[model samples]
Target: MNDPDFPRRIRDAGGRVTAARVAVLRCLAATEEPLTPDEVLERLAQTAGPVPDRVTIYRAIEWLAAHGLVRQLATVGRAARYEAVEDRETHAHFQCRGCGQTRCLPAPPPPLPPLPIGYVAERVELVIHGLCAACRAGERR
Candidate 1:
């Protein structure tokens, strides 16, 4: 998605607005699931202009994540995936164990368990792992 506010969002997040950063953020914002750096590069290549190199895409994603403009999802021994942070209610995610496909689920995050006096919760992540519809169908065939 070509969001006109991307540049402004970067600036607001105290980051320098660059083409690679903008493109990376835009690409992530356009997708429903988090994307790896390589996936970002592939999507950018399919777009109508010069695509940033692999390193550039990595740096852009890193910068975005550092700036809190994007959130990196836990992939555990796999390529790190990133998704743009949007202004909405926090939700959970569903990951297909077979295909590694991850998608946002509308389920609200569960309430935080009680913590000790000095504890703090920065974020909540609830991931449901199972086969997606397509993967389930494939297994039946």
Candidate 2:
């Protein structure tokens, strides 16, 4: 999805407007589920012609993640996946153990128990794993 305000968003975050960055962000924004670097490259390649090189894609992913523009998810037996966080913050994801498909789920900040002194939390990743609707239906039949 080509978000019209992407350029401005990048600028507001002190990043220069560049083709690779824009393309990568658009790729991330286009999908509901997070994408791995290889998947991102594929998406970009299918769009026009040669996508950014592997190194460029890596850099773009790192940059976007560092800038809080995307969220990174590392599930078991899968390369890290990235999802655009342009809209909301602090949500959960549902991962299907049966089909390995992941979906975003909205959530308010979860209540937490008191923590020990001198410890702070940075990022929260919540994944609910089970059979998705289709997978569950397949099991039923």
Candidate 3:
């Protein structure tokens, strides 16, 4: 994704797209998998000059998340992973117990259960945990 386009999107979302913001967005777009803030910092360091501190990354993530541009996934005993929010389908994640790898899997459409009389549901995420293919193979061995 182009930096100009990314900054434009951030501006459209009422955000100021600084170099840090563009770097973070570019890093997220480059990956097929979601990444934690530390992973994001590492990738940014390699390509985007000196990496922004974790505090800056956290602030950027908060801004992006608040503007509905990023989605966060909480893993067990680890930092949350984040991805750009271009799609909103119900999905499940396969987490490797051994290596802590997380793979996203498409899930069935959510059932429309009745909400309480005065309640509304905005969003939902269902995550499933298990061994990935490599971990499973290793277990078999």
lDDT of each: 0.88, 0.81, 0.77
Q: Which residue ranges in model 3 land beyond 4 Å of their true spot?
A: 87-90, 106-118
lDDT of 2 by residue, 1-141 (tens): 556787777777789877777788888888878888889998888886557898999888888888888778856557788898766676778888887787778666567777799989875677877899999999999
74: Cα error in model 3, Å: 3.9
Which whole-number lDDT from 0 to 100 does residue 43 have in model 2? 84
| Candidate 1 segments whose C-alpha is farther than 4 A from its true place | none
What lDDT score is found at residue 106 in candidate 1? 77
- The candidate maximizing TM-score is 1
Per-prediction TM-score to the true structure, in the order listed: 0.90, 0.79, 0.82
lDDT of 3 at 100: 81
Q: Report the C-alpha displacement of residue 14, candidate 1, in angstroms.
A: 1.6
Lowest summed lDDT over 10 consecutive residues: which window, candidate 1?
73-82
Q: Please identify which of the two predictions, 1 or 2, would achieve the higher lDDT against the true structure.
A: 1
**RMSD per prediction, one decimal?**
1.7, 2.6, 2.4
Which pairs of residues clash in candidate 3, taking residues 3 or more apart in a chain or in different chains?
none
Q: How much is the lDDT of residue 131 in candidate 1?
A: 91
Task: Please provide, for model 1 over 112-134, each residue's C-alpha lDDT reduced to its tens digit, 9 standing for 90 to 100.
Answer: 78999999988778878889999
Overall local distance difference test of candidate 1: 0.88
